[model samples]
Target chain A: MSAVVITVTSGKGGVGKTTATANISTALAAMGKKVVAIDADIGLRNLDVVMGLENRIVYNLVDVVEGTCRLRQAMIKDKYLPELYLIPAAQSRDKTALTPGDMIELTNQMREDFDYILIDSPAGIEQGFKNAIAPADRVLIVTTPEVSAVRDADRIIGLIEAEGKYSSDLVVNRVRVDLVRRGDMLSTEDVVDVLAISLIGVVPDDESIIISTNQGRPAVLQNGSLAGQAFRDIAARLTGQTVPFMELDGHDSFMKRLSKLFKL
Target chain B: MPNDRIKIKGTSNGLVITLGAGAWPRLVEELDALLGERASFFKGGRVALRVGARLLSTADIEAVGQVLSKHHVTLWAVESEAEETRTAAAELGLEVELEPRPISPEQSRPTAGDTILIRRTLRSGQVVEFPGNVVVIGDVNPGAEIRAGGNVVVWGRLRGAVHAGMNEELGEMAVVCALDMSPSHLRIGDYLALSPADDSRTQIVPEMAFVHDRQIVAEPWSV
Candidate 1:
């Protein structure tokens, strides 16, 4: 089966692009799909660490592109999931070591072997971001609810549209329901209105996500975490499933009480 | 085939280059080579490009202008049949129409108003400029800008910066009207004003802004 190459990018740094990529890849693999996650951030590679496979890396994406290692030799299989693989970036090299053409050719070679190929794009609108999206069938833009992050997301969306890639979507991360309810933060609707793009997922702010990252494991593997559920829902949506969005604002009970009072 | 893409003709005003149909990058490359071939003949010359029916973005037009400027050619105007291309040229503060040929009085004067009607939203980082009046049917989001020689009107929200009455020759009588009139910065002629920080309430009536006593002011739009 041919793989769908999805690129996850954020124009601003520390907005959880790497976290989202690792979690989504894990969620998709847990659903019995063969998934390969590529860390396109060459100089600052962290996907291997997040996936808890740093010690297993014999080769990397730069090695494969430079023809020093075979593609199979560079792919580090996950310890728990047999269907998942990780192609970590070269720590010693920079973004210039890989070009857009190399990314496209490399992904094309794996198209027939996997069901999903997710590329974790580097921060900024530079060569690394271009390389990640070069072979993408769809793009997921990750952003926080802050104005600065939303502004950067808008710029990235404009660039993606200008490149003639029409399948780009948005994923709002680190959304605090309490802040939204208190009118201190931008709501999901406000972000969607400004960006004018379809919303794929809304990941709430969770402390377990940081804990999971520190322990070198994606939070999506934790069944009890709300952030993990959000990633799972996003993965389900990616696989053509219609899962309802989680209610994060704690307003459902309030609304129900208000309706009951009106009836009484 | 390469030579046919760019046809240069000398005129009394300047050189008029007719750019043939093709991709924008290839056209830029060919124009670069053509300029390089006859640098002395084209040096210190004004150019009016005749791009027939091709819609060019701001970046594409800027690239072409840069190529000409590198060879000491000043791009004074751009003549195009496409409305988008004309608007793009006008946005760069370049004349959309070339210098008039010897014309009869009837052909020289027209009866229509010089106003541009834009029906699309101006997103962040997009700029629309014209030497005449401008009427937009969509929202002007934050970071977008509009510079007009005359009046400006927005049927939707006006949260972006706008400079009206840019051409002093046209008389400083320009006004800016918007359905929701909270702009980051507003200018009428030489006067400038910023939206009040605490005025976050939604506007119920349309508002018009104009220069009054050497300062910009906004009032309820009536007549």
Candidate 2:
């Protein structure tokens, strides 16, 4: 089956684009679908480390484009999921090393072999951003519930529309159910109303996500974490399933509620 | 193909056509030939033709005016340091006054009273202004703004800032409603309302906001 290239991007940094690419790729592959995750942040490579495949980098995306290696040689298989692979970005080189044409061509070739291609886009609306979206069949914007993040997401959505490309969606990451319940944070409705785009997934703020990231195991691997379920639901939706968003209303921590009560 | 024509520049006030040197009959003939070639471009256009000291009788000015009229163009005024051309233009009922300066906004702010509808959400950092009603079918994100002289309507949530009836008092109302109503600030006339905490577990339904007792108050949208 041909791959569907989806770019995960956020205009603001540290909004978890790389983590999303890793987790979504792993989850889709776990479902017996062949997936390839491409780290489009050429200079600042982090997807490899997050996916626990940092040590096995012989050929990178630059090598594949520059004819130093075949496309197959550059794809590093995942540690646990054999159906998943990652085409790591070049750590030593900068974003200018690869052109948008290179990215488009690489993704086109990979599409013939894999069922899904997830691109981890770098932050900002620069050359890196262009390279990431140049080959995408769909774009998933990741943003938190904060005002600043939503603001940046708005700007990115405008730019995407300006480029004459349509069919883009939004995913609100790291939502706190407790804060939302207490009216201290923006809820899913708040973000959707502001962004005015179709919502695909809403991931809750689970501390287990941080622990999983540090250990090079994406939270999606746990199969029980609420955030992991969210990612899986997102993958299912991407595959044309009508999975509803995983509800996080019952998981609000007692301490979180207590802090809200004391603050008010 | 006739290069014997005067060149014209368009300004807000009128057109300025610079005359070329030639025999009187030849010049008139050339002007006629030139206007004929591009009649559509100059149709219904008002012109101030500049002829530099070319001696002309009333007949010459009449001939030029006739040629201009044939192309549906009006000769508004004549520009020249030449005394004779000015006298001829004044004799032909055309104004001899200097070209008028462009009217600035200080001279006019005539409201057309036209309104523009924005069908998409006004996201953060997006600003829109209208002299009349501003209707938005989507959300107005925080840090975004909508300034209108008449009224404002938001079909979705409005968590951003908005100002209505900017030039007047609370006469012009600002209404913002969404499935979830939360705004950084909402202003109508002189009244402003800072957003309160959102209510979760409450299925957000459509709501409408308006100025109440010099403050912004929201009510559930009903028929």
Tell me, by DockQ, which candidate is best: 1
* Backbone clash count, each prediction separately: 0, 1
lDDT of each: 0.85, 0.78
lDDT of 1 by residue, A1-264 (tens): 999999999899999999999999999999999999999999999999888999999999999999999999999999778999999999999999987768877998999999999999999988898888778899999999999998788778756654446688899999998899889999999998778789999999999899999898889998567798899999999999999998887646744654676687
Q: Which lDDT tens digits does candidate 1 get at residues B1-223? A: 4665579898876789998643456568879998999999999989999888665777789999999999999998889876657777766767777766465434323122478887656666767777778899888878889988888999988988999998786535888999989899998888888888887676467999887787888899776
What DockQ does every candidate get?
A: 0.11, 0.10
Residue lDDT tens for model 2, B1-223:
2352357787766788777543345456777877898889889988887776554546777888898899999887776554435544655656655456475423323132434466666666656665556777777777778877667777776777877767564343555556556768777777777776755535666777787776778787777
- Regions of model 1 farther than 4 Å from truth: A251-264, B1-56, B59-86, B89-120, B133-135, B200-205
Worst ten in a row by lDDT for model 1 chain B: B104-113
Task: Give the proportion of true interface contacts each model preserves, from 0 to 1.
Answer: 0.06, 0.23
Tell me the tens digit of each residue's lDDT in model 2 across A69-126.
9999999989999899999999989898876657877887778888999999999988
